[model samples]
Target chain A: MSYLKEFTKGLVKENPTLVTLLGMCPTLAITTMASNAIGMGAAATFVLICSNVAISLLKKFIPKQVRLPSYIVVIAGFVTLISLILQAFVPAVYDALGIYLPLITVNCIILGRAEMFASKNNVAASALDGAGMGIGFTLALLAVGSIREILGSGTWFGLPLIPEAAQEAIKPMTIFVLPAGGFFVLGCVIALVNKIANRKPPEATGCAACPNRESCISVEKAESTVENTKKEENK
Target chain B: MNKLFVESSPHIRSAWTTQKIMLNVIIALCPALVMSTYIFGIKALLLTVICCTSCVLFEFAFNKITKREDTISDLSAVVTGMLLAFNLPVDLPVYMAIIGCFVAIVIVKCLFGGIGQNFANPAITARIVLMMSFAGAMTKWTAPFAWKEGVDATVSATPLAAETLPSMTDMFLGFRAGCLGETCIAALLLGGLYLMFIGLIRPATPLCFIGTVAVLSFFYGGCDVNFMLYQLMSGGLILGAFFMATDYATTPLTTKGKIIFGVGCGLITFAIRQYASMPEGVSFSILVMNCLTPLIDRFTAPKALGTVKPKKEGKQ
Candidate 1:
């Protein structure tokens, strides 16, 4: 595959968050604030890149059956390194990230990349894939985080944008900060992205029009088949 | 000019178009609207107008953007707007009321395919959303006639949540703190009776719903008549039973299904009122029942005259 294709695909076409819907726990939890999103994204990116590189370099030595547990170990080591660095230098981000900081070890994106790309590709290609996927995940988190922060808390990155006077006049919909608000904003953002990409929503036509109607033994089909078998036996 | 219009099995037609049904509902709602204006002052009418205008505008805008046929003329959005406003406090900010309308029309109604295609009742769902999101603002109920006398919006407890019950006569005449259109039992009854008379709404669902509430509240109140009457007149029980619970799109289709839906609403409303912290439970109850409408319909569907139910697999 082309090197450019490998790097660009994760940005939109196969976005880790929006397209693949991986790592949802952090995507929903830390996205309450734009700053939190950035911190979480950066931390995850560091871990993902390190883990991908390590896994790719050692791919030949690792046995196929034990690759998953081995990959987790590699991911956990890098996660610990990033977590300790964040805690030592940037205490605020560390506190804000909370339990989610350590959760990077099991973030599906890291493990997914290790299994899907790093295990098969060389170190350089795996690292590039990690960076692209990391950037994609960060952008998605930033989009959701910024929207939720501005509307939910009336601030973006700790800066109060909606003036106090205007806030008095109009209360920002506080629901955006709430969990339900997270769901609503996420749904709208995903819908907007899907629309921009000109994606067709899945059709919800019921079983009557299902494409597998021929082989599927629905109630009507079962009854008809039973009747046919009974008639053949009688004849 | 005697041309035969050949068609499928449904050759017979009725005069009840969507527009006619919605217009009839709007007309039925007029008595309560007028009563609310007199009781709650001009703000009630203003809120109603704002909600109706915005709901239609939102529906229109959504249709324009989505390239669908404009359906605002059918007046369903107007009905949804009126119902939503009726569920809110009269003193609620016009913009908040507009937000509720957006939730009702655009999000709940339109996004779910508009009008008859929605799963839950739009107005009920919007009221719940607003109530949950803006708990303090939504629960601040002003006393009856406070706006007329310029009483600085003295917040008072609703009859349902009040320490001492108001006189039955006052409650009947709607001189109590509650949502704008739900206070006046007489006006709601008149509107409901008119809808029944015009055949716009069947009496089965409303009667069963109100009956269940009355019976349950009576037993729950230790067979006290006055307590049962007070429970019946307070909150949105009358408005929800007569107007919302009878919504054609959300309620069940068959008579048996309607009764089941009504009983379920009554049970939930009773549970919420007696146990939950929230003062009122009518909207939540009706919305919950609306969610179960398909299940109710499926279970209570009328069997065809000559068709036997299919046998079980093990039963030859």
Candidate 2:
């Protein structure tokens, strides 16, 4: 794929969390509420975008030897800025995201993009890559948040979407919102997505079609054996 | 008269096979097997028997019903049965143990394409299921035979009970209140040592696991020695750390990878018991570490004999 297309795909078609399965720490840790997801996503996007842009610009100067340290410094700076901004303006998100917000500096997505795409791409392409990844991360967080909050607390964004009776009955997969739950759910989501993406209908009229036919044949054999056993027993 | 032998296409034979390993584990489990029956009364024996019979029966039936290769003769069913029995509380209802057996053999070992393909330990998964569904019975702890009258019975604290916890010496000595097989550290160690001696198994996995936990606990943990010891002793730790966690299919291959796997189990166990809601973390911790076994193996691959470490990760 071309650099520009690769960059754009990170947005949704190959979103980091939802599609690409990169950077689970932030995806699970910060998405407890919708707002936290937004804040965390914003922090990650800012770092992702800044680091990508800076890495692309500095790609010529830094030797391949020390490029990793240079990228880390740039990413760390952006992460610090996000941390300072949150601490001052939005203490709640700052506190809630806690270790995770700063953890964004090391998130595989930012470092991953810097190493893989940003270092190799032009400034414009790097910027697009960052934005794409940011949007994808945000959307994935929103999906997880929506599912967790609705089920876990019977409320979305502190608003009661559930009726009084339904609220009482809501057993919230209380686990889904926990850090562990985030991972388990994330794993399930990835498996499901893989299943869907790799989904295939019954194969027909191709050489590729019949390789796995033995399992079907075995099923037939099983049925016949059972029938034979029943007939013998009845006699 | 000329006779042609056509059984399993075996041209050469060795004493070792999958069935042999499975039977070895069954034999190793006998000490805990006897201990559990003695402590939990005849019901523990009954449950053990029931689980063994049902697990084998279910495995055979499922293999026939599904027309896959029949697996009961391999003794995996027996391993699952013994492991299931080890996980169950002696006081637990026979039917519950049977359900655990069914789940262990049918769902975990069978449904997931069987044996090696199953993502986690069959017995541990079944234990988790039964622990969740039958919380009350699963946690029923019987006092040691000597202490039943003095401790006031009613599920009194285990010997490894944490700071201000129960008797540490009792836990070390295997006289405590906990799961059927998990209460006795010494006996489990003996069994593990025996397995290691006979060349049936190696100690590289569980020793690193238990050693890491002990070292970490001593250095960083404020939870009392007994509490830590109980953590080691109670709830399938030895059975898992030594036997189940050492599964060749599930655990890593290289020595370095095995150590890393052990360390991962320790860290998770410490983190969960310290931070999470669960007090007993062995089964869950082992299952979690088991999930990472492949990744750990991938990352810490050993330099193969007479070769260099491959850049792509798996071997010299």
What TM-score fits each model? 0.86, 0.55
**Candidate 2, position B151, lDDT:** 45
Worst lDDT run of 10 residues, candidate 2 chain A, spans A207-216
For model 2, residues B245-281, the per-residue Cα lDDT tens digits are: 8877677777888888888887887777667877777
In angstroms, the error of model 1 at B250 is 2.0
**What residue runs in model 1 are displaced by over 4 Å at the alpha carbon?**
A84-88, A200-235, B1-12, B219-224, B313-316
Number of clashes recorded per candidate: 0, 2
* Model 2 residue B120 lDDT score: 76
Model 2: fraction of native contacts: 0.00
- Model 1 chain B weakest lDDT span, ten residues long: B4-13
What's the lDDT for residue A84 in model 1? 91
Off by over 4 Å in 2: A1-235, B1-14, B146-153, B158-169, B221-231, B302-316
